[model samples]
Target: MKTINNSSKALLATMLTVLAMAFSTTTQADGHAKPGDFTRGANVWRDNCGRCHNIRDARELRDDQWYSTAFHMRMRGGLTGQETRDVIAFLTSSNKPARKPIITDAKAPTASSKASKLSGKAVYNQTCIACHGADGKGTLPGAPDFSSAKGPLSQTDDILVKHVTDGFQSPGSPMAMPAKGGNTALTDADIRAVVKYLRSFSK
Candidate 1:
């Protein structure tokens, strides 16, 4: 019984030592930026960083991680040394806890009982064909062809709706697909109809 007690005590001591080392490493990795520095960083980020990348919500990365990421982006985006440091200061200072995005079911408006309903194809031609093309083959560089068998429409309806509404950026591409083709007037139902139309052409 005495030997067993001694083994348990030694094990507890070793665990405490490991925990202390972990805490020390974490503190060194995530040193805090100076206060009031984030505002300057924000301006720098908007001028230099906003052109290529979306301003990520602060909760995405820890203060330390953000510094490292900003340094890398500075090199890639050709930002000046001062500009990079200012942006890092802003990201770290403005860092806050991330809130969960609210996900709600978007309901489509009901068609009038006596009115004729428009077909998805009709909607596509009238509204979408200009950008997406008649064959659902997008001609623009940033646009993806729905009929090409390599586009996002081949995925599920939910994914298509999200992309169409929220938009996306291809890695290394300078341009991004704007939300609802950059038309804020598009309703959730309109986006859903477009998704349906696009999916029909998937090979």
Candidate 2:
């Protein structure tokens, strides 16, 4: 009876050990982004999508427009379906501008005041015209013409800002836009002003 009791105790101990190992493995796996992990979506965007497009601010497109653009780019850009979805989820969720409080005070600048005062033409001349041309037509192989009717500027201020800040590398383009036009110092306000300026040139 003593031997049998010892054997049962050993078996129970083994079972507990197995269970513990299984639980540990699961916990570790959860710590990382799985194929479906939206939590890791931002990282994925930074790694993969950020190479070509801005990923931080959402002033570019409305949520619905982002959905379509992401899906189309996923196919043309060779992103896996899961990766595309992850990036889309990140952009749609985190890129929007914050809503301002309603205030009756006369001192508050209207929403338009929040818009940057810098001229798009000045910003372009200072930074972009070398690569994109004075007309906002891209001069280099990888650069895109902002004047193109089909370009992102035709969308909205929100969409343009998001794209500019995130950076984008189209498949055929040899060079990609660096985040914030390769001027890391450019503030979000600067990018918005540039977007507004570029839209003025669009057909």
Candidate 3:
């Protein structure tokens, strides 16, 4: 093959640089929306279903049923392809009956638990914002309005933490919220951060 001239090499380098920049921009835009993360899946589930459907029923369906329902709901719910897969993964994993009895008030995780370095705002944005809107008034009917004077925020931190850790249903809400908002990977520290962040909305 003929050797490239200096000008040709410079032009090729410029083109390669442009391509790299475009790729980097695309990756940044994608951010943490990757489909396989249990956390992202939990966020997607809350955004799509928590507003209208009962999130506590994930265990009631088989894997195939979850798959079928996710696909069917994708268009109606406006789920991206990534979100559809993520929620399916969430449902599949969540469906298994726990062999060990669930502890309602498991103490704060020790050094062995999965730890989160995210600050309270970051944690709330990732996990809680989907159901609880940015204003903390709640995005949908069943979610408690954190901004209300007598709402969930009025409770002491310990009660709020326990409710989030163990799952809770408001007295008249349509359904119960799943523990750890269905991420299941949250540590007590993360839950505390989220509770703290949510408290900011009321104050």
Best by lDDT: 3
| Residue 68 shift from truth in candidate 1, angstroms | 38
Q: Per-residue lDDT tens digits of candidate 3, residues 67-138?
A: 879888887788876788788877776565433334443564453245658787887776677667788887
RMSD of each: 18.6, 13.8, 10.4
Tell me which residue pairs clash in candidate 1.
38-90
By summed lDDT, the worst window of 10 consecutive residues in model 2 runs over 29-38
Per-prediction TM-score: 0.39, 0.41, 0.63
Runs of candidate 2 exceeding 4 Å displacement: 1-117
Q: For candidate 2, what's the RMSD?
A: 13.8
Candidates 1 and 2, the one with greater TM-score = 2
Selected candidate, larger TM-score, 2 vs 3: 3
Residue 188 miss distance in model 3 (angstroms): 0.7
Question: What does candidate 1's lDDT look like per residue over 87-165, in tens digits?
Answer: 7765664454222235433443333112325556765664456446678776444556678656665578898777766
**Between 1 and 3, whose lDDT is larger?**
3
Model 3 clash pairs are none
State the local distance difference test value for candidate 3. 0.73
